[model samples]
Target: MIDKTTQPALQRLRLNLRQLEVFLATARGGSTRAAADRVARSQSAASTALAELEAALGCELFDRIGRRLQLNENGRALLPRAQAIVDQAFEAQDLFLGEHAATLRVGASFTIGEYLLPGLVSRWTQLHPRSLIQLRIGNTSEVLDAVAAMDVDIGFVEGSQTHPDLVMQSWGHDEIVVIAAPGHALAQQCATPQQLSQATWVVREHGSGTRQVTDEWLLGHLEQVRIGFELGSNEAIKRVVAASDGLGCLSRHAVEQSIADGHLIELATHLPKARRKLAIVLHREKKLGRGASDFLAHCRAAAAF
Candidate 1:
């Protein structure tokens, strides 16, 4: 039923994984030689594959300037789809070897990475002993960027931040607690709004999920508060608050161990309880590999209880 002329066109339309892989490598590395090094092919072969892809697509995907190849409109449009296809191919290949043979790349905000993911990752690795996970830790904004750029397969973060390119799913919930050293003035008292507003606070740095929540919760209740320190690390804030008279606000998970050790005390304050939703984020266009998909399932199952 097919014509001979149409059959040749259909064959030309077929795009191969090797072409896409080379395309991705070139887009990332910016040169045929770099693409060659990345995909373990010769520079000339990489160039030939790229030319074939452009010819098949009937458009130039990049803008050439001297030795640099920058993604133009067509390339930009094709990048995500190409990435998904290549990723799916690798995932499918790994599937037959065993579920544990695939590698997963995950990104997480500081609070989730340091306090929450450890136990979950520990449990997951135990079950899939041969699986490898590369976890990158950053703040909420950084996690969003990594997920958007496909630097990681998935992301877990705290608070209510959203990215246009990502799909956010509520994973769980967390509570933010106000803390003080056991010997601090507020440790044994139910602090009033006026006292809290006057107190020196040690809080998470800007761009942090905890910091965003802290600002919203505290500012909503108190007219104005003084920030004594803005730190990147939860542990650093805890230590500063414990050694000084400054108050601290952090996740209950981050502070629980210190609270239990009698080094820090959860403050009784007049402000309302602060709670936030934890979320799992993934690129809207991304197709999850089996290992990453299974890991996501594992996390969801754990969060159910």
Candidate 2:
């Protein structure tokens, strides 16, 4: 027999799945209008779906401000759960869509992607030839943004984690060394934070994990670490330090090649070792698919070996 009380949810509008999809779309797109475009529906339809979703879920998922939808704390809290639902739903879709063509999107901050990730991703491709791997590289801050937007499967970043949407687990560690061209006077002197600060330094652009930690660590002596230039790549920074008298901060891994060949020398700072955590970050709600799971495992194995 048909039940009358459940008709609105069951018969009139169907289950809340589509509305949930609309809610997620709007959250990710930043607007109901944009969400409509993603799902090929009208703006009114998307807005209605969101309204109904909020009503049925008994919580306001988004706060409408003028023409835009901004997620409130409640909405922000639901984002991970909604994203996890979508990720699981997408994985289920993969079973029907043919798993081979599904792409695993990954985000890695510059240092890890440029210096460490390619080898691991390359090895993963060989092991799972049918899977596709896509990498998005940026500073840790930017990478975190991409992860929040659901643009990537995972992120490997340097520095401590800040975002509430993401879960950060230590994947490895990187040792930072202060370096200069072989003959720079700082190399010969006892590298106190004060002496290090006095010289002009070329550093990674702001929001880089490297820049963030170095900035915090050098707080009492900012005057000493004067800005010479803010370059984008670790390699470029190393090159600048190599060709000029400017000093730089670098990962021990990034400069090992140069240090062995005697181009850049690590300064012995009065401060103890400068170590930054390399963490694997992903949305707390995002379920790892088979390919992503395989990749995360490979990352741990590679770090160990």
Candidate 3:
């Protein structure tokens, strides 16, 4: 296997934005025709661009099985770098259009994106009327990946673990509370381990920060609890818990409105209160632009937890 790091740097100079863009579009939409539509180019042009890009990079980026293209091992390895390059180019352009009229690209995990960031973004916008705020929402891992790749100026995440390539700044503390519908059997009483173990659980889908924390905190204690359903979003989980007899563990911020409206009830568990740090993440080597720095400062000063 050829070590990519050992490759000549000259190959990098041969890369063009159009080629990378075509490569990305083809990789994502899985065909040159689709890629052509995305990049507004002829199908033959997209195909030629991808082929030239692969040749310049010294490896085939995709496996051509009949007319369908799939990312091979080499393609998979190059995809992140290609995405980072393309996204960073756009971000750089946006950032340099005007320093004070800066455009900030922010990525956020589910909890912060849905509940916390709107207010912060609003406040930031008020402070800097000329500033542009673009927000991307994903699970903790996805947000972290975006930061590490320099796709976002910064990220807000609720997961306990931090990546080696990223730096995490303590933003605030969040409580992870177990909850249920008001009519649930355990809703009105403190639930013991055995009693909790028997109740069905509805949880955020696997990649979610909430799911990770629950695995570490809840499952660690009630090792054998039944998981009745695994849901994709915190809102979905909340809705399921509120309408059904199942129980769920989620961030306090996520369920505050539901709990207040009597759609859900925060349960008293035998275990101690579960809390985790919410953090702002960025690549360790990232040099923050003025806009990013300003927003980071605002986050540090504002008490949102």
Query: Candidate 1's residue-wise lDDT over 79-191, tens digit each?
Result: 88999999888877887887768678899999899988988999999999889899999999999988987778999999888999999998999999999999998777899
- lDDT per model vs. reference: 0.92, 0.83, 0.86
Q: What is the lDDT of candidate 2?
A: 0.83
Runs in model 1 lying further than 4 Å from the true structure: 1-10, 25-56, 62-72
Candidate 3 residue-wise lDDT, 175-265, digit = tens: 9999999999987789998888888999987778899989888778885868899988899899888889998999999999998988888
lDDT of 2 by residue, 157-265 (tens): 9998579778898888898788899999877876776777677888999889999877766664455568889998898999999888888887887888899999899
Which scores better on TM-score, 2 or 3?
2
Error of 2 at 132 (Å): 2.2
Q: Candidates ranked by TM-score, best first?
A: 1, 2, 3
- Candidate 3: C-alpha RMSD to true structure equals 6.5
Candidate 2 displacement at residue 193 in angstroms: 5.6
- Candidate 1 clashing pairs? none
- Candidate 3 — which residues are off by over 4 angstroms? 1-103, 149-151, 285-287
Q: What is the lDDT for 129 in model 3? A: 81
- TM-score of each candidate structure, all chains considered together: 0.86, 0.79, 0.74
Per-residue error for 128 in candidate 2, Å, reads: 1.2
